[model samples]
Target: MTTLPDSFLSLPIAHRGYHDAGSGIIENTRAAFRAAIEAGYGIELDVQLSADGHAMVFHDYEMSRLTGETGPIRTRNRDALTRIILKNTDETIPALPEILSLIAGRVPLLIEAKDQDGAMGPDIGPLEQSVADALKDYAGPVAVMSFNPHSVIRLAALAPNVPRGLVTCHFPAEHWQLLNEKTRTRLRAIPDYMRAGASFISHRHDDLANPRISELRAAGASIICWTVRSFEAEIEARKLADNITFEGYRAAVGTG
Candidate 1:
């Protein structure tokens, strides 16, 4: 089994770069990422492949959620996407290289590869390939993870030295309903973390009590939990996870 770097377990990750729309610091924007770096927190962000095959740092397959534009993120090429403003802020969507340069290795970065099955089939390989290509020469504390096991496996093949993780949740949301039983079961069960060469696991904060997690923890696997919004939630997650990816409430972070 691959052991994750100490920084991966020690740092308090800023979910979406400590985003706060109320302050005009939109999630996945340059301003938000700078805030995390200035505050000395690791960053967790999502990336999707643009139409021209560049890795763009943004969340959701569609641009509407975080931007005024309403369309799939892939429809726009990198240059076009980089020029568009995000939400109501002055910040524009950033490319992966821009973010990597902005940080300049000031803190750790966790890149989540956003992908899913599409009309053409599993639409994750190209996304993984693009992300891998972007990070080829990035000399920083970094890791890649995905809710899709295939992406994780691909990263393992394409960039073996970079840490890989499996992001999972047991919640039965409506999205899971759309997946076939086999695919849904694989996602919920998360049986390929070890097989996929993942060095760590990032699970939903509320779903950390599964037996598999406990067994992995017992066997010395690194575990982290995500989107912890409250001090109370962080405390609960800390009992099972080695670290936290959090937002909303900032607490005194300990390296424990």
Candidate 2:
């Protein structure tokens, strides 16, 4: 297995590129990624496949939250997505390759392959394939992770040289009802990560107290927490996980 660079564990990861939409550095935009690079912090970003099979650096499955547009992100091609401004800001949606080129290995990146589309079993989804293709030629300190174990498994098979991780936690109340009992049980325990041969765990910050996470950490697996927003949460994360993926506060320098 390819080991992740030490910087990925030591430096705090800027969730969505140290973004501040109020300041026009919208999440996943080039400006946000540039800010993260300037701050000398690692970055954690999301990726989804576009209609034209291009990989895009975006978060929501829909464009409504970030952009005023009302449609699935994959409905628009890369050019059309680029034309849509993010939240009335000057920043437009960026492609994965564009952001990767902008970073140029300056800082490690944790790319979350969003798997909203049910990507169960062995078949690789288009998003996963697109992500693999985009990263194929890039020589950067990067890792791929996903809430869906299948995505991680697919990437592990496709890009064995790159580290892969499983993002796991108990589902929120709103999403809990959508999952069947078996799936919920599996996610709650995160047993699929082991089955998928994941090298790291990007767990929900609060859920690090679980015994499974401690076991993984004991076995020398990398453990990272997400969405760390406050100093208190950072303190807790420092205690349980190796690094943090943070946003909404001073995550770039660990002041928050």
Candidate 3:
């Protein structure tokens, strides 16, 4: 394993490629991915198992939000999924393997998988073997991430050497004092994240700078921020995060 950076953890990261709002080049699409790769940016995209256990690139819980469909994406096979028109364009969701093959070694891909929660229609259940199986032959830098800690555990077990990142953010639900107390306990156990063989962490830049990242870094973990677009935030985060993922690929100081 190569050593990464503490400042790299806080760098400017793009939010799923630099697609303008309401533009056809939306996040997780092949066009957006290509743009990111061409721009030399570290790209972040989502992956979910299809009906046939093949990984498909997507970020939403359903296609309705992007494609205006009422059904789920996992229910359809590659052909069917490919046929489902995406927005105004004829392009459909691309398979994960295909995306990797296309990108080759041009850039690194950050894959965020769905949780075991079966609520968002049907897809492959949370299984380490399943995720590992799909990524077995993938060359170049690959990192798996999910909000579900259990999924992180399973992925670590299946692929001991593969880097896993735990994605988390504070939701507006609990009281400050209560949330702080609960967060402390959660933070303590997070060192166990290293036990999960996690090489990096994909979290909000604010979270990385909140002392938690330093704690995790002490455990020999790479801290990476998600969706850092602001210039000020980028500068501040560069002091904390090890690798910065951006959409436009404006190379600054440091590398992953």
Candidate 4:
């Protein structure tokens, strides 16, 4: 297993590195990422391929939700992708490698594999391999996680010891105990996640601070909550889990 950085394992992550500055630069852009690094928070960003197979920093499969582009991200070339103005900022889409280099040794990164409409996981291996290859000699901590746990298990075959987090939503109240043999069969083999080396559990904000979270922590799983937008949510989330994933890293982060 790769030795994570000293403060790497215990720090909160800024989701897409604090992009909403009312400046037009949306999440996953170079401006946002730079803001994150400068703020000294760990980074968590997503990746998808351009039309020509270049891995670029982006979170969703379609730009319609975040960027107002009605097409899939993969349909556009790098230049084409970069040309779309970020929601508020003058910045354009950013290349993953460029973002990586900008962060340098500043903080840990969680790179998520993304595809439009959730139909093309099989095509992710090469993209996964390419991203991993790019970060091979990276001195800072790095990990790849997906909401599709199968992709994580698949990536395991090629990249061993790379930490993966099981990204889930609306986690059941009984997340720690293994019950219901049927759902167990269909689920991503969560035990396999622990067995394979998932150091963290990333769940929605609502799921934090529950008994199940305590249970997972008892099992040595690091609990991380997602997209904390408000000060109240941030305070409460910090009380429940080991780390939090926030989208608004733009504000001066104090205490919790």
Clashing pairs in 2: none
Ranking by TM-score: 1, 2, 4, 3
In the order shown, what is each candidate's alpha-carbon RMSD?
Answer: 1.8, 2.0, 4.7, 4.8
Q: What is the TM-score of each candidate against the true structure?
A: 0.94, 0.93, 0.79, 0.80
**lDDT score for residue 182 of model 1:** 64
Q: List the residue pairs that clash in candidate 4.
A: 23-88, 23-89, 24-87, 24-88, 24-89, 25-89
lDDT by residue for model 1 (82-151), tens: 9988768888888898898988778889999876554212556777888888788898898999887877
**Model 4 per-residue lDDT at 1:** 28
Q: Please say which candidate is ahead in TM-score: 1 or 4.
A: 1
lDDT of each: 0.82, 0.83, 0.63, 0.68
Runs in model 2 lying further than 4 Å from the true structure: 119-124, 252-256
Residue 240 in model 2: lDDT: 87
Indicate the worst ten consecutive residues by lDDT in candidate 1. 115-124
Name the candidate, 1 or 2, with the larger lDDT value. Answer: 2
Best by TM-score: 1
Per-candidate clashes come to: 0, 0, 11, 6
lDDT for position 39 in model 1: 79
Which of the numbered candidates is closest to the native, going by highest lDDT? 2
lDDT of 1: 0.82
lDDT of 2 by residue, 1-256 (tens): 4566777888889998988877878888888889888888899999987898888999988889998899899899999988888886877888888888899888899999887555334444787888888889898799999988888888888888888898888776566566677777767787776666777888899888989889988887888888799878899888989889988887546432
Tens digits of lDDT, candidate 4, 16-126 = 876766765467878777877777778889888788777788876678876757788888988898888766567778877788788886878888776332432344565
